[model samples]
Target: NRALYRAKFDAVTARLSATLDTVTPPAGFYLWPKTPVSDTVFARGLLEKTNVAVLPGSYLGREVDGINPGANHVRLALVATLEETLEAADRIADFMAQCYSA
Candidate 1:
């Protein structure tokens, strides 16, 4: 299970790196990728277009002085199977490519 998870995580991270910046956490089930737009907007569009749901990073953190550190990111949970995670990453890359290509 650990090897499976690491392979899935690495594949997804590589796929998403084409468009969104991702940090390789020392250990975690979630990927925090920086979005090109507002995190909420990005999350909504991703769900609507690709049928992939992610938590807007803003929802995971508290606002400090009207600034949410996670406002420009989204949290992608790689808890699915390897195939599913890869598919999600492809969809995300395609969606973001189209978004910024325009």
Candidate 2:
């Protein structure tokens, strides 16, 4: 049932949060709004530069007004190793900084 599935998802997310040193969402219904576009480009540059892979938000039907809502956003896999993820995050940050500086 949906309730059971939700419970399992919450449990898994909790474990992932603990492992990743991230915060868990408050206990309640949660909606993961698609990542905004600004985040997408940063993520893509990171993956392309680092050889890591991620999905763009537009691929998830977040496109709007003929514009990709996630055009600036990238979808990272929580399943990747922590080190790989950290590297991706670092790359994204650097790329974004460079973009703004230019």
Candidate 3:
């Protein structure tokens, strides 16, 4: 499990390096990256465009003082097989390039 997590983590972080602010936790099976758009919008668009599902970070947080800490983030799970994880990362990278590239 650790090996799988490391591989998926490296692949995803490298793939998204140019497009998102990927937050690396000390140890986990998830990656929470700041999205260029609304987390809900990004998650929906990613699913619609790439068939890759992600949890909108907003779904994991509550609004505090009129600000949602996760309003602009998305959570990516690294629980798939290595091949699927790689494919998802590629699709996400491509999606980011198409929709959020500068």
Candidate 4:
């Protein structure tokens, strides 16, 4: 059972890594990371606004509540087409810029 799990994990990881390598974010933003994780409000917002999806860091057990888990970052799946990903990146960059400016 473990062997099967490992095999599937390895195959998915390898394919995901290879996919991430070829992706390019807009001009300012970048991929969160090449890992399997969960989605967050911020990530969800991006998906809703730009039709691009991302996993939030909290979803990866980084910012769990009621249990201090230290610093945990999220991994994003940038498996969308170049155009869609770029659009999403642009939207995210703009949103972040506005948030910081405020």
Better of 2 and 3 by lDDT: 3
Candidate 1 lDDT score at position 82: 85
- All models: lDDT? 0.88, 0.47, 0.90, 0.44
TM-score of each: 0.94, 0.45, 0.94, 0.42
Model 2: colliding residue pairs = 37-72, 37-73, 39-72, 39-73, 40-72, 40-73, 40-74, 41-72
Q: Clash pairs of candidate 1? A: none
Q: Model 4, range 1-102, lDDT digits (tens) per residue?
A: 444434433443344343232233333223444322223555665567656565555554534457524222334444445455445445655544543233
- Tell how far residue 21 is off in model 1, in angstroms: 0.4
| lDDT string, candidate 3, 1-102, tens digits | 787788788888988888889866779999999988899999999999999999999999999999988899998999989899889999999998898888
lDDT of 1 by residue, 22-86 (tens): 87787878889988889999999999999999999999989999999989999999998888889
Best by TM-score: 3
Instruction: Tell how far residue 9 is off in model 2, in angstroms.
Output: 15
Give the total clashing residue pairs for model 4: 0
lDDT of 3: 0.90
Scanning candidate 3 in windows of ten residues, the lowest lDDT window is 17-26
The stretch of ten residues in a row with the least summed lDDT in candidate 2 is 15-24
Q: How many Å off is the CA of 73 in candidate 3?
A: 0.3
lDDT, model 3, position 67: 91
